[model samples]
Target: MSWQMADIWENIAQAIPDKPAIVDGDKRYSWAEYEDRAARVAQVYTDHGLKPGAKLAIYSYNSAEYMEAQFGAFKARICPVNVNYRYLEAELTHVINNSDSEALVYQAQFAPRVAAIREQLEHVKLFLEIADGSGEHLDGAVDYETALQAASPMPVIERSDDDLYMLYTGGTTGMPKGVMYDHKTFSSALFTKGFEMREMTLPEGAAGFGPLTQALHAADAATRSIPACPIMHGTGMWIGAMIPHALGGCVVLFDNSHFDPAALWKLTQDEKVTDLTIVGDVFAKPMLAALDDAQAAGKPFDLSSLQMMGSSGVMWSAEVKKGLLEHIEMVIIDSMGSTEGSMGASVTTRETTESDKTASFDMAETTRILTEDGKPVAPGSGDIGLICNGGMVPLGYYKDEKKSAETFRTFDGVRYSIPGDYATVEADGSVTLLGRGSICINSGGEKIFPEEVEEVLKTHDSVYDCLVVGVPDDRFGEKITAVLSVSKGTQFDEGALNDHVRANLAAYKTPRAFITVKDVPRAANGKAGYKDAKEIALNALNLEVA
Candidate 1:
């Protein structure tokens, strides 16, 4: 069955044109208003000679226009590639060239970067600027609103489920690779298993679905979802932003850009947010700290409206989950997913037991893990190996067919999407994710996951954030090393930090050396850039290599 994303807006606008569809600070947009604006944007794209199936890149922070531009592109049947606004010239150029994007819809704040790369983007025919209050202007770019004003609100062109949307995965091994998804695969993989099944699914008519058919009847009943992470990231863009909107529910955009705990509290309390989605403890830690401060000050915000709080992108601590639950009266869920396989591979819901919480990974939902020998291991064995899957995996990397064919393969009659994450399946079928297999440290015949060490280090009082990596060691083959961001007004104590890890984890898992700085290096999605961290860690270890 072919499904067009434009149907989502059409259904919402027809049913509840006046109802609020988006809330960003004082700016509120009803379904009709948003549709009208989106249509105009589509027209604008058409006028700019951007035809259907053409690629358009959106580079901006979270805003109402971001959604408008995305839906507008869907209306035109043109693929919209959401670029990370934080990308530098080198990173941005790779995406622009890889996608062969013809137009770029960006915020005026990034005019300088645009100017720098304008000459290099040969395929880019138009630069449409979404003017922020910055009062910045580009020499050859047209105003976003002005361009839209000339175009008529043409009817949305119907697109088949086979139509493609490209999402680029964070490249720890090298440059980022574009992961393409058709509508059917994206919906079945990302929106179906974890999200649609968990919560109360909305009525069929509430969304674009007709009277409950067999396929629709089987979907989960939940209508609401929240994506607290940036829309540029996969979880944030796909699960958090698109899935919720496609369901015709409200998308609560946290526009603070910079995460301020108090601001999050205020937004939650004021907006009566139902589902709070986060990207690990980096986002949650500060909110928890704010909640603590609020309670101490006797001005605690009421977060009773929240039903479910979820963490993805990185592993969140059990301690942090407990702290967040104190403020929110709902289920605390931890999910493990990657851009390669869309969003959710496995999830631990509020119903998950305390014993389950102790385990580093959750069980697979629609996917499975296998060892190097291609044998599936029983759960709880601590026998870690490659993670493979069978589901709505992408066709392959765009343009790089060789790499794509290697990564996207079929084993034992099942097509698996293996992104090379190392994990152990528990006895009860729960999956314990060690870390990315490509970055796993093998020292003295022992496997060490950087994420495990990093999680423990983050809980340290003086450590703000940390990244663990394996550096070359003649004695152990590869020695574990940690690069950390110290908290404000704090000094690094290598011995104290090492002792802390030693108490919590095995000696082999603990970092052999520590380097402290003001901030830990990370990618746009908040995932640790181990390759970059390794470079810094190796330099630091070289001075003290013993």
Candidate 2:
């Protein structure tokens, strides 16, 4: 039988019941206690009439209860949907409605936003709010702790490997959609040994799993990991929450709404964190800056216990990775993956080659480059193709058949997840990822779709037309830039345009800089010319293409 995540957690809890399972700020939960808390949360959901397989939306900052709610949903065979806390009213309402969420669990700080959209979300039958040091509370919403304490702990329900693990991801279409994956496939991507790590084979079968499970508990000391990114993201949740628990280790979370390098370093030294996960240069740059400042101040943090530091989603520059290696003699695994697919080409700083630094990656054995004609492109062919992952992929986007068909396809009788990433297989068989074909802007690991920003910018009174593009940056891998064609004789007000976008969408999606153009360039078919807009922004910013 294929292993389910809930079952795996139960097995690990049985093996290491007294060990710390999760440490969030000042709060800690032992393995046994964590399971008990999850059971209570699950019972609360059922008591509220949330049935098995019902969808629950988690909308909050990184917290222990956020994870408890997630595991509880898993225990109850309920699907938990990750809601980006950065989303404003419109975006939040769209996702909650699209997911058919029956219940919403959100932080009290975001109560105003939720309250604004509550009238539109008729399907959401229950609201559970966690106090965020704010005295604010939404009317008619149940307190999270009150509900958890009142409910009786329920027995773990039988779950199949086919249980749903849904992740809502923003795409080039300018809206967020849920990517659907069964627990079996998700586990294969997260837990199974990759081709580069070991022999490429399926995860242990039922017959071979007994000894492995026993050895997993007996042979290894308790490991500790800190997820520097938000748990709402795939990298943070998997590396920080799920993977550690699955391995019977401890997951430490910083108790802050924003990332703080000093606090993160302090926790690492204090807890002796074994694993650390980051997202590209946005995280690495600040961390390195803080480390440098700490050493100069004569109180260098002892990160000796850190075993591995990894990044996913955005680009973790080679310079930053090398700097991190100086502080700790460990490899930096710069994983290139998305919510739609896992384990593509991972660029590692293990061997430290001169040229193969940041964007270059060693393709996984099952990963391949397929041309538009559905033929495998040979290495060094100089042909651009979609970087695809074969075997045990997601089912498809929930309720979006058009996108699901476009993303997951079958070629030569084998199905693969083609996530719209353009790459070239180098002569040495390494892959040099060009970028996303969808033109998604990644600013500090946050995905910002150009159309989403463009739509907002065009709504400005001074703006007649606009196109948004990503420009290279030192801190954030890419920053948002907007090229505009204002109304005749109307001057561009950057502040006004920025505030417009910030009011309508997440603040991060707002343009950092604006450039006036003669006219917004468009093709004959009336499509925005992103290439031209990108060049315009780069020239205006006086940045050279690296």
Candidate 3:
């Protein structure tokens, strides 16, 4: 079916005006209220001189206001750029200015940071702050709710299906790049993936949106998804909010800034949520701990309502998935993809999990593994190639044509998005993802993917979390080092870790040293960040890293 999220959501608002759209803490907003508030946000953007094709960046946590502001940009036919909330001054300025953001909506807590760089970001013309009860406000900034109350709801104008939808890179390796998608391309993928998750197909014609939503609601198939990760990120927004909203489902947001597995479980129980979105093991470990603690306390949560749990962006171990399955008896989805384009995912239920392996995923229809010379890799030939995606790919990075051309290209007359993720083709038409090539380690002139070693470390009981990095070594040229985190007073044996790594992978891939840190570096969205880990490893060797 040909439809845009803006038009479909607007129609849903008219058809089911009283349906719950967003729930943050004790606050609830229905479809009518959601549309009205988003329209007011659009009015605020208009009043600040933002027009179609202008960019509006959202730098905030998972809150009702965040999604409302995003939807407002969608309605205005403007690009909504996501800003990482954990960004410092320079990073903040780079993102806002790089995206050509004319308007910014941020949380009150980040006002000082924004103020520090306000002069540096010449593109920003308006600043709107969402209150966090800190009373911290940016100078000359508009209060979010106050502006909504004062301005009239903007009239629903005809928005182009070609309006851009941007998702900035996580910036773990370098400065973030904005990946742009026209609403038509993105919305089509959204519907296709949404229906695929439900084992359904999109009905034909322009009038299908309302009926599909109503049917799902009538069948109690409408999801109540709680995104435990940051809403500013892709997984949380796409799988957490957008897809659920498309099915006329309600999205629940936790009030706290930090992740509390116990609280997330409590909220899931209280909301009777059907889906929970999270980043891989960084989120799953603590959540599993919380579940165990509750069971020990004889006050286990009522997770019976939970039907599916999805994780992306980082490594999700098979052990964690089995642990969660034992408790909730729900489907666990491990997605292997990036913001640029999705390749595929692995969904595990209780019966199918015995063979559950880490990082092995079924391929999407348009996904392929191609060698450097633009030839498809033969299945089970033990040849490694870059994983490329074709259908519904991005337009390119916002303004960087060089990087865009390198990533999005036509190989053998078919356009594909090759984002530097190396994998091997399996005999069963699957791809065994070997981490990103940019960060792969070259030790003794042998290429090694960190994900393999990291997953091996995670299998150890004493290791809570870890990041593997390469440090300069005199003999091997580069030493594989592992930075790890564990519970206080719990220690790991280096010999045992080495043995474990050797058992799973070759001796060359085993980490030479292990450094303990209170916490491993990860992005706000829980994706592994190696910049800090490399520095920490180099510091252990008295070698400078910068």
Q: TM-score of every model?
A: 0.91, 0.80, 0.98
Task: Report the Cα lDDT for candidate 3.
Answer: 0.87
Which model scores highest in TM-score?
Answer: 3
- What does candidate 3's lDDT look like per residue over 212-301, in tens digits? 878888887778999889888888999888888888889998754788899999999999999999999989989998999999999999
Query: Order of candidates by lDDT, top first?
Result: 3, 2, 1
The regions of model 3 sitting more than 4 angstroms off are: 204-206, 487-490
Worst 10 residues of 2 by lDDT: 194-203
How many clashes in each structure? 10, 0, 0
**Residue-wise C-alpha lDDT for candidate 1, range 186-205, written one tens digit per residue:** 66555554445455353432
| Model 2 Cα lDDT, one tens digit per residue, 364-403 | 7677799976888889987878888876578999998998
| Collision pairs in model 2 | none
For model 3 the local lDDT of residue 77 reads 81
Q: Cα deviation of 57 in candidate 3 (Å)?
A: 1.1
CA lDDT of each candidate? 0.74, 0.78, 0.87
